[model samples]
Target: MNRKKKIKQILKQKAKKANDKLNPKRKPRYVSKAERARQEQQVEDQ
Candidate 1:
C-alpha cells in the first residue's frame, strides 16, 4: 500500500510538470536602451 501511494504521488508530480510545460505563464522580457530608442524612432517616423 505504501509503495502504491508513493508511485501515485510521483505520477501526480510528473503530470503537474507536463501540464505546466504545456500551459506556460507569461513573463516580462527585458528591453535594452538601444532597442527602445529604435522603436521610439520608428514610431516617430510613422
Candidate 2:
C-alpha cells in the first residue's frame, strides 16, 4: 500500500521478468480435468 512497498514490488516483478527472459524455463502443459479423466480411462482400457 505504501509508496516504497509498491516501488519494491514493481522492481521485483521487472527483475523476475528479465531473469525469466534470459534463462527461460520449460513449464509443463496443463491438462483439464475432463482431459485427464479421458486419458486415465484410455489407460485403464489398455
Candidate 3:
C-alpha cells in the first residue's frame, strides 16, 4: 500500500509537469503593417 501510494504521487507529479509544459504563456505571432511591407519587399527583391 505504501508503494502504491508512492507510485501515485510520482505519477501525479509527472502529470503536473507535463501539463505545465503543454500550456505555457506565450505571445501569438502577428505581422504588423511595416513587417508585411518588409516581407513583400523581400519577395520582390527575390
Number of the top-ranking candidate, with TM-score as the measure: 1
Candidate 1: regions farther than 4 A off: 27-46
Record all residue pairs in model 2 with backbone atoms less than 3 Å apart, i.e. clashing: none
TM per candidate comes to 0.54, 0.51, 0.51
Residue runs of model 2 more than 4 Å from their true location after superposition: 27-46
- Predicted structure 2: lDDT: 0.95
Position 7, candidate 1: lDDT: 100
State each model's CA lDDT, in order.
0.96, 0.95, 0.96
User: Which scores higher on TM-score, 1 or 2?
Assistant: 1
lDDT of 3 by residue, 1-46 (tens): 9999999999999999999899986887889999999999999999
For candidate 1, write residues 1-46 as lDDT tens digits.
9999999999999999999999968986889999999999999999
lDDT of 2 by residue, 10-38 (tens): 99999999998998668878999999999
Worst 10 residues of 3 by lDDT: 20-29
The ten-residue window of minimal lDDT in model 1 covers 23-32
lDDT winner between candidates 2 and 3: 3
Q: In lDDT terms, how accurate is model 1? A: 0.96
